[model samples]
Target chain A: MKNAVAAPLTGVPTPDLASIFGGFFWVGISGFGSALPFAQRMVVERKRWLSDAEFVDAMALSQFLPGPNVVNLAVTLGGRFQGPLGSLAGVVGLVAAPLVIVLVAAGIVARFADSPHVIGALRGMAAVAGGLLLSASVRIARPLWRKREPWPIAIAIAAFGAAAVFRFSLLECLLVLGPLGLLIARIRRHPTSS
Target chain B: MNSPLIELAVVFSQLGLVAIGGVMSALPDIQRQVVEVHSWMTASEFAGAFALTQAAPGPNVMVVALVGWHVAGLAGALVALTSLIAPPAVLAYIVASLWRRFSGTDWVKDIQSSLNAVSVGLIAAGAALITLSAAQSPALDVVIIATTAAFLGSRIQPLWLLGAGALLGAAGLI
Candidate 1:
């Protein structure tokens, strides 16, 4: 198992940096609101860069790590094939076109900030964005509810309180709650086993 | 005295490190610091910028770059984007390399579950905060927010919802 793990994953083509860049660049262009789905389709189905299981694994690790989840996935998958430079290529491709597009849009919006039409549209967009975020939060929290775990739910509530109700900075809340949550998880994972 | 660009770098890099659950989990803090602490933007302006992020493609973390551009310029955008991406990207690269070796270990599982809880909570808080900040007309925004949330997990594309919202606003319904 160790030897198998150490070797490069067989049967998967090792894409060059340009391919990685182009794949993510297309995802950047085509992904409307969220890029994860497009990225999954491209990497797994089209490019076959990684198998479905590996993609899921990368996603799991990306979630637990930091930054944007898709960005992390890009870096992880990129590094898996071609090391640090691969990671760089992946990210630059993913973000470059989108970055330019957003900045240009923002500049236009800012220029028209005083327009009543713009303001109305922005207000509507903001409301929808807020809804989208809440939906995402619910999706993230759903698994915990399904598992029927008490401690994780409690920790989640506590985190919400620390950040929203108490208005503590994110850093402070994480500092206080991160370890406590970890400890509970460790205890819960093996009440008697191990 | 720190330059604005330097301040943007400092602030976003810190955000990058603590962005354990992704940029969504960091939204509230981003809102507070950019709007309240630095006075770089008003609350509504920040909301507008954040809304634009959703309308754009690519990663949501581009919000950082948008804020930087608003505060400074192209240079500010570059600085903020790099700072936010570099730290976390480096951490992710290191962990991804090590992950396969450690995949079988129970430690990864434990961290995954715990971090999920932390991430969910932060994201919820962010949801509430953003909803509140984005509410220009309490009644109309509430309906819009509720309708949007109701469409969650549906086959309907999110762009359609956003477009609906823009149309509603243009029609003076929202």
Candidate 2:
């Protein structure tokens, strides 16, 4: 009965700014195309700072907000753990290494942009990267599996169609679908007493 | 050739403002602004930078930095990247603070769920867009499908897949 109203989770010790930087800095260097898996493993399994469900909640929150999802997650998670400085630390940790590495690679690659093998490899890499991204989408939307409702699926399809098929401007599409989605979610907001 | 550091910053900042679901959602627009609008780089070069991001560690948005370097050296790279990341990171910080304070509420959860639903669709669209642009041959198409299926079905690491791609391409198989 004490737990019936879903009291906010408490007592997870917040990591200091240094650990925050190190954890996400590791995420920066370790990830390939998408950092969500690595970030999830770091915070959820290794750091034990946030539980699995909390990790998912953070993912959902960051995915919709502006900026890179990884950066947003880092900022949000870092802020939750410490404060604004932690937020800055998280983002700097996630971005600093890749920024240097990518710039250097860009420098070297510019000299070789014309080689056919390099070009072909680049093209092939794009296909696989696309695959990685689509696969990630399949993975990120896992919670819908529990809902067992068709409306969420339908909304997803409509969004995919509008963006991928119709090629409407992204802002235009979001504005149109945003309210409908809220209405659907509102209808299903019955509170469950745990 | 005239695309400069300030231009990179201004364009990326504008992109940052309207990039509702992150930079992948803004890919085509980035292509538009970077390739056609500003003439910063060729379309093929832009595509190549994107591929570089896939191989390099971290988020795919690193392609912007690559594009910046390609055009105007280190300063351009710094400008493009900071403009794209800084604004949104601040916004994320502000929103995250508020969200943490109000997170236990039911309405907040409901709104989050709604946004989540929409994100599912956006992710699908983003994957489709990248796939369409990259997979132009039957062999590449097979690579795309196989990699995607494997990723969805198994826990195979993405680095392994990218390595396979590089090997296939180096051997001229794709």
Against the true structure, what is each candidate's TM-score? 0.94, 0.83
Model 2 chain B: lowest-lDDT 10 consecutive positions: B95-104
Worst 10 residues of 1 chain B by lDDT: B144-153
Error of 1 at B168 (Å): 2.1
What DockQ values do the models have? 0.69, 0.55
Query: Which sections of candidate 1 miss by over 4 Å?
Result: A1-12
Error of 1 at B78 (Å): 1.4
| Clashes (N, CA, C under 3 Å) per candidate | 0, 0
**Regions more than 4 Å wrong, model 2:** A1-16, A44-60, A80-82, A141-146, A187-194, B1-3, B17-21, B28-44
Residue B80 lDDT (model 1): 91
Q: Native-contact recovery for every candidate? A: 0.72, 0.72
Candidate whose DockQ is highest = 1
Specify the CAPRI tier of model 1: medium
